[model samples]
Target: MQIIVVSRHLKSARTITIMPRHVLGALAVFFVLVFLSSAFFSFISLHFRLPIVENILLSVQQQETRQTRDYITNNLNLMATRLGELQGRLLQLDTLGDRVSDLAGIKPKAADVAEKPGQGGPFLPAPLSATELQQEIERLATAVDRQADDLAFMEFKLLEKRVEERLMPTTLPVKNAVFGSGFGYRNDPFAGLRSRHDGLDFAAPTGTPVVAAADGVVLTASYHQEFGNMIDVDHGDGLVSRYAHLSAMDVVESQIVRRGDKIGAVGTTGRSTGPHLHFEVRMLGVPQNPATFLKRGEDFARLQRR
Candidate 1:
């Protein structure tokens, strides 16, 4: 590049030649200075509220902040509602547990464990704070956990005791059957003399099903001289039930059986005049009145239903 310089001081003219590289360098420097100056002015204008674009950006940022806060509040409220529902259910279970314990005649000593599992206070027409709700949720959760464990344990113990009680010879061996002969002394049909009858007799038709009185193990199931097609079930704690004069025996020796299990069929297979079932309950080989045990069992069942 070349530039012509005119100097009128001495009435002379001079010509200067510039290299392409130097000219390009000078142009580059000028462009860089212009860019820096433009950037500085832009920043100053935005910082001093000199542009409408800046105001719009600030408003968008504020709106986003409010929306975030609202979102957080909504989420907290939802969580609180779910927690309240759980707490309500827990309360019902607690009440049911207490009721069952009273019915079973068992009381828990650790009722006031950790915290009381109940709700009470003044009713206010206002929303709860997030912090307060969170704390309440924690407290309720703790109480429910403790009570649940306690109730589970209590239920197990009661269930075990109930099962033990049921596994006794306390129910009728024949279902809905009437007694044909009473216990104690009776005139023997074969001997024609007063003899002691050790058991009650139910006059049922041949093949009338006879069930077990309670849960027990079949100790003996065989025929005898006086009792035909007999079955003896050994209940726990030295209690036993005998069903005699059956046409057929369904259970074998040593087999475990539950209450109401079909153990035999009714028939007069022994030295009797008619088809009947002889039922006897004994404790440690000592005979007991069958009516006493049956009555007690019936009463207990009625109480449970209520």
Candidate 2:
């Protein structure tokens, strides 16, 4: 584009040439000037705290503050709900600990007293602040840890009790057998003289199944001149059990056996008057009353049935 300037003072007309690039450069410079002016005015208004500017700034700050407050309140509410759930779970663990303590025959700790019933008087509501809510959550967490420890101890005690019961000679040797002679002094059937009978007798038919009274390793499975086809089991802790006068032996020496495992069959072998099983319990080589252990076994079985 071209533009002619008319001037009477000039000897000739002056001609100016305009291009698209010049128009574009002018537009860019105009935009820069406008932006600088606007920034300068904004700085002055803020520094002087103009009424309109101050009101607008205050409104924006208030909105941000409200959003932050709402966020915090929601978080606190969530924490409080979680704290209540943890308390309920702790109560359940306490009840389970009590039941397990009974089964394990362990006395409850002094701190494990029963919880008091709920109390009520007024319905006044007081909201918890952030600090109070945090403290409560921490306290509840500590209580949960304590309850977990108590439960763990109770579980260990229960397991120990079960192990002891398994090792003791408490199961009946011959099932459905009639009780014959008792332990202690009695008349010898063959000699007809008073003699100390070291074991209890169970009368059953020949070939009736005879089982182990406890878990143990077989120490001897051989014939004794007096007991005849006898089996001795070592039940650890210096306790041993003997099952004598068997028609057949099913286990061998050094074999492991669990309670109620079949070890032999009933038979009246050497020095016996009839088909019967001679059961004896010995601790450290001294004879013990087998009846006591058998009675305990019966009680344990009854509890299991329940």
Candidate 3:
């Protein structure tokens, strides 16, 4: 390619030669630079201004954050509810265990069974942080585990105690009976001399039912000259209860009987007394104090004194 230049001030016309490849190369370079500059500026503007794309991205991120928070909150609430239920069950177990211990005459070791968890005063408390809540939950879980162990041990002990109590003489032999002759030294009406009374005499009407003191098997249910119609129950561990001076016997030898079951009816057939029941609690053939085994209820205590 050839280029011609005319200079009117110089009054001269000149002709210069140019290469086609060189001109094309220069045009290609210019276009390349323009494309690069345009791309750089477009990237800068997109980064600074972002438009609706930025809002869309932010919305997606916010949704994800909200979902994460809700998931955490829901799980925390579930855990809290479960923990509350466990605590309630633990409290119930404690109450039942205490009652059983009372019946067994066993004292409780820990006094904190009635105490509640840690509590804040009237001041408003701040919400626990994540770490704090987790720590507290773990602590509560450990406490629940410990309580479970204790309750299991207590339940086992209570069951053993129940078995033992059933085989021991511990209740009244006659219902609504007044005290007649007490245990120990007293004047014998028949002999007219000071004699020893080995059992308590409960005066009742004729044919008043006499119940067994504890769950046991009848050892002797026969008539004797000194006892009239009588029944003796052999509780386990060398313990026995005697219901003597009866008008009629309801149990036979070797018959199983529970506490409060009718064994006979009261009578004065034995030695001359009013219609009465001669109740005796014996261990190894030796008489024991009936007051020592009777319950400590208010009415029973009054009856015991009477």
Which structure among the candidates has the greatest TM-score? 2
lDDT of each: 0.82, 0.90, 0.81
lDDT by residue for model 1 (150-265), tens: 77877788898788778866666776566666778888888889998888887768888988988999999999888988899988889889999999999999999998889889
For candidate 2, the TM-score is 0.77
Candidate 3 lands at a TM-score of: 0.55
lDDT of 3 by residue, 174-291 (tens): 8788887777989997887999888888888999998898899999999878887888899988898888889999999999999889888999876756788888889999998766
Q: Give Cα distance to truth, residue 173, candidate 3, Å.
A: 2.2
- Candidate 3 at residue 19, lDDT? 88
Q: What lDDT score goes with residue 94 in model 3?
A: 68
lDDT of 3: 0.81
Quote the positional error of residue 211 for candidate 2 in Å.
Answer: 0.8
Q: How close is each model in CA RMSD to the real structure?
A: 9.1, 6.5, 14.0
**Stretch of 10 with least lDDT, candidate 3:** 296-305
